[model samples]
Target: MADEKQPAVAPAPDAPREVTSKDGSSHEEITTPTRPPGWMYKGFKVFGHELWYASPLFQLLLVSLVCFMCPGMYNALSGLGGGGQVDHKAQDDASTALYSTFAVVAFFSGSIANKLGVRLTLSFGGLGYVIYIASFLSYNHNQNHGFVVFAGALLGVCAGLLWTAQGTIMMSYPTEDMKGRYISWFWIIFNLGAVIGSLIPLGQNINKVAGPVTDGTYVGFLVLTLIGAVLALCLCDVGKVQREDGSKVIMMKNPSWITEFKGLFETITSAPWVVLLFPMFFASNTFYTYQSNDMNGSQFNTRTRALNNTLYWLAQIFGAVIVGYALDFAGARRSVRAKGSFIALIILTFAIWGGGYAWQKDQVTREETAEEGFVTVDWSDGGKKYVGPMFLYMFYGFYDAAWQTCIYWYMGALSNSGRKAANLAGFYKGIQSAGAAVFWRLDGLKKPFDTMFGATWGLLGGALLIAAPVIWMKIQDTVPLEEDLKFSDETVADVAGAQGAADQAVTAQPEAVRTSKEGGGAKEVV
Candidate 1:
């Protein structure tokens, strides 16, 4: 067949060949040394480095100060100009509306802030807050509840934007190693804000109002809001980074509005587990809203508030520093610890919820007795009479602190890798918003027959408690190979095979040269 064509042969898998060196000498294949993953090592280092300077902690403090200053004024405003003297239901509706706005705005603001730099978004929020407080002052002069609600909505929007940005900034820039610790510190400072906020209202002295108590409270908020705004401006810088090519750039790029709207939806679709964790946030916030309303009603006077705040902060500080360090030391795979913490938090929330229910019942009994003209015990005074409420307050404080600590810890742990943190935070806010919306809508429902608001909240919290451990187990079972394996078996085997082939080639080369010399009249087979 025209001098039969030689069949093509494939290279042997074990064959080795000389590789050229930089100096033109022939050498065998070079080996690359094994090294640890950069993300893991760098993540640890980053957590230790840059977490504290972010301003969420300080911003929370400012918001708390401003928020607490207005309750007395708002109460008075509701009663001004003989406005039918206002009832608990009216106040509840107003508060719900306000908080609902806060929840929704916060969710939207967070997404926008993620696309836009935290500094610019937060600074704008602060300025808007100033405008909101000014509107409140204007409302005080006008005596219009509608204007007050509008102002409150504006405040909610501003607060939502700033808080979302602050949270995102904290979550994004830190290393995985320090993420828990840094977020713990964030909560610690946030609790400190509650302490300070509770105290700021003490300075208002609404009982000794120069004009209406509403007027005095509005003035107080105005001053606090101004201070907050100035601090925000000083702390935030929107346009700061410059590229190597000499082009100025913002720290974050703003995405299209459509992208911002889709963030929550995208997160839920991508991470179904995120949806499961959201109910806990919602339940916790509902409890908080109820407690705030109770406190504002003077159910737990100033001293009680101070004591509760102090205890809460103490527990938070302890949990964050001590428990956070423990989690770090227990190694990176402490899914079990996160589960346990979540369970403990849920138990504590139940205790708080039960205590709140009991407290409400007691208040109703006292009101009924007073209405009947019966001499009631003044348990607000000393010793044994006050012990029950004091015990409740203290326990509630502990519960609040522990619950929040566990929440931050769990979130940090669950969202330790990939793009989980951003997704988790966004979904958490959205779920909390959904819960608030439900509760707000339900507040209009008439009762004494039956209602599901409290029961639904309690059930949601209980479900989350049960779900945490199961989820933790699943996470542990499906631990990523990249995270757990020191080296891939296949990769190691391939490397070993290459080395064996190299050794065989090295051993065979001299014999082949010797044979060639003998066959070619003793000439060297160079």
Candidate 2:
């Protein structure tokens, strides 16, 4: 409220607004209709109107593209060094740093997104991924690990911003009826980074290239990332995201630093969030470190990395799409979808996966070089005939798909309104980063594979186990099924609920694109 007008109380619950913060701050956001004078999009046309360019669906696509590029390149690049298996501790060291930094950065991402607007926040975060990838061009194996850690830190900061932006925008663009479909599609498009990035390394790791990394191929990947970064910068600004009634979703409020700080504190301290810390926090890091360290090329040749990732991504794509439908099929109850999906993602349910890992553990042979890093066991004896792990890792796609979609989608239910929802999404990634940082500390102290399998089951899988019962029995969102409601409920009293309604209609536009207004003018609310 520092730089904005006083909040206006909504006459109805269906109104595009929140009446106040949980912290007892009395602020009523206003939703008002005010379109730019119609010339901004120029001649862009769909159905003969120059309005299609401004549609939230179009904006969502641009946002998705912004989310795609850098991480895709990083996924391809992160798998490159140490024979794609040997120097995994180094990989953990870098990743630990990435997530550790990400935790702190994520705490602030919502406020940053609020202040800078979504498009710019996304661009800023994407650039961080690009820079982290570029830093890899100078990797010199054992001699330059510190540089890798530094690069990881850079990636961590941007990732906090990027993921928060992604979650907020994705959640903001769909109406109650189509959210499941949209969330499912969003997961597929976003997770394509993993699938698509896998191909780059497959090409780069050809034995003909000799070393684990090929400089020329890596340079090409950098160029592709550069192009992607530029495109992300071209997305629509937040002030332009219009709702179904032509009232634009405004996010321009400049709340005091004290409010932002308190909001961050409140989010981390919430009961629902405390319950999520064990199973979900650090969950990605555990899964990823295992993937990067153990199963990647442990029992097979480096080329198999691409084959492995290809299958993993494909399965995940199917998993993501199916999970979307599953959630929708479960209907509007957040408790049902959240609990049901958690039970389904229980990695242990796929007992065959653990069996497969055990089968491969005996097969892969490793040996260390004369490098000081040789202090570690060398599994490099071409590791056993790596045939089983490729298939084994693919099973995680389903697990990952279920975990990612449900978690991000459920965040909307946990919060009372859009602004709080943004922060909750930030915590989803942030606290996890803190946990990842701690797990990654296992890097140099023990055989990476031992820690990888142990932590993967212990955390990623454990989180699901803990969440299943807790979400079912104990935890519930303060704003349950908030996204499922159509904004207006007949039971609520209203005096002037129709005041903000606009006559002009939007087709295929998002109902979630909330419009806000204050006494002086329309204030953008995240």
Worst 10 residues of 1 by lDDT: 241-250
Tens digit per residue, CA lDDT, model 1, 1-526 = 5423222332333343556645554533423212111111212223234111222333333333333332212322321211111124433454456567767666566456656655566666665555554655664466556665566566556656665555554553333455556556665555554444434343453232122233444465466556655555444332322111111111223355565556546555655665556667676455443433333223434333334444444554565666556545545466666666655666665766666566555453323422434432233466744566656555655565565455555665443221234445555555565565555445334221113325544655675765674456534412332331121112222322234434444455755534432255332222
Q: Whole-model lDDT, candidate 2?
A: 0.58
After aligning candidate 2 to the native by TM-score, how far in Å is the CA of 416 from where it should be? 7.0
Per-residue accuracy of model 2 over 1-526 as CA lDDT, tens digit each: 3523222322332345656656554444544433323323334543232344456556666666665566666665554433243446656677777888999999789877766766777777887776666555666334466777787898899889887877777765554334556677776766686677767677666453223555554576667667666887777665555444343442324455566666567655654445554457557555655565555544344565556666777677787798887866744465667667666766444574466457645643333222343222222333444434445667666666766776766654454333555676677778878877776676445554654576566555566656665567543533433232222121111211223332111112334223334333333233
RMSD of 2: 11.0
What ranges in model 2 sit over 4 Å off?
1-51, 79-86, 140-143, 207-210, 245-252, 268-274, 330-334, 347-353, 360-387, 473-526
Query: TM-scores, in order shown?
Result: 0.63, 0.73
Residue-level lDDT for 30 in candidate 2: 47
